[model samples]
Target: MRWMQRTWIGSTITLALTMLFLTGCPKRPDVVETVPRPMAPQGEVGMPTPPPLPKVAIPEEKSPTEVAAQPSEAKPTTEAGAVPEAKIAEAEVKPEPSAEGKAAAEPELALKDIYFDYDQSAIREDSKKQLNENIEWLRKNLAGKVTIEGHCDERGSSEYNLALGERRARATRDYLTAAGIGADRISTISFGKERPFALGHDESAWKWNRRAHFTPSAK
Candidate 1:
């Protein structure tokens, strides 16, 4: 009985000492370690690439000579006051008409004496053409004044031939006035057998002597 009691006491003291030793010592905390990761390239190494943008055609720029070679809108060209060579020469030089040409143009204007039959005051058939020509001349020269001298053949008295000559002169004046000549532009005179164009006493001389002569004067 004494040996069992002593063994039980030793076992109880050893269990108590082991529990006190465990309670007296402090516990240690757990330690955590952080690991650094390696950096990757752009878009992660094996990412898919987007499709290339649709290719657009770009026009090339042209130089001055190349642009000028292209056809452009049509524009009207001007002479800029430049006269033609032919016109300049024509303006600078002109040829005057000759005196012979003047004579030709004025031949119709030369006043010709219109003859009458023996002791007649009426206009003769042959004298119509000559009278018309004289009227044309007077019309062309509007500023010309005319004197119609009436003549007679040497066959009557001085007073009687003068009356006849006056009749002839009046007849000539009437014809001229009726053909559009102004009466104010004409003057009448009697030269009854005083001035004879043909001196002989024949039909030719008498015909020439009995006439109306036109003398023109410029205004």
Candidate 2:
């Protein structure tokens, strides 16, 4: 009986020691997870570039020579910018004449007469009507040109007579213009008692000298 109890106690003690050793032992480490790196592009090894900017329009400047090459806008004018309407009308339209009328109308100008003033003067009143008639005749006949030659009585100095003769001629020309004669066809010169129609030292000679003679220029 004593030997039997001793053997059972020994078996119980060994079982207890085995249980204690299993409770005190360390545990094993778990698995660690890892992520993979991204791969590079096939052709290029850098980042993508941005798109290029759009093109812009720029204006060009005109040179001075180019500006001058442009056409001008101003119009030309006649002499002194004065256009004579009556002269233009006369040139544009002409009147036909009969046979006798043509013979009479053929440009024939003559001084044919002498005008007189009181002694030592160049004033006349009736001469205006005659000068107007002569101018009208010249305009109607379409005479190409006419000249007025002025003279003075042999009483004043030669220079004074020449000046006075010019004054008379100018007065006659102005009257003719007022009577509707074209000034373009009429001209004036001064003889100043140099060319006398009558050969005498009397009133008749002075009368002839103090006149304005008309002469037609050959057409």
Q: For each candidate, what is the lDDT? A: 0.83, 0.71
Residue 11 in candidate 1, Cα distance off native in Å = 99
Worst 10 residues of 2 by lDDT: 107-116
TM-score of every model? 0.50, 0.46
Clashing residue pairs in candidate 1 are none
Clashes of 2: 0
lDDT of 1 by residue, 43-157 (tens): 6767555666999999999999999999998887657998878898999898876876764566533777788887789998888888888888889878878888899998888
The best candidate in terms of TM-score: 1
Writing each residue's lDDT as its tens digit, candidate 2 over 68-127 gives 999999786567867688888998898876766764665453233336573333437777
Q: Could you give me the TM-score of model 2 versus the true structure?
A: 0.46
Model 2: residues >4 Å from true position, as ranges? 1-106, 109-123
Best by lDDT: 1
How close to the true structure is residue 20 of candidate 2, measured as C-alpha lDDT?
Answer: 84
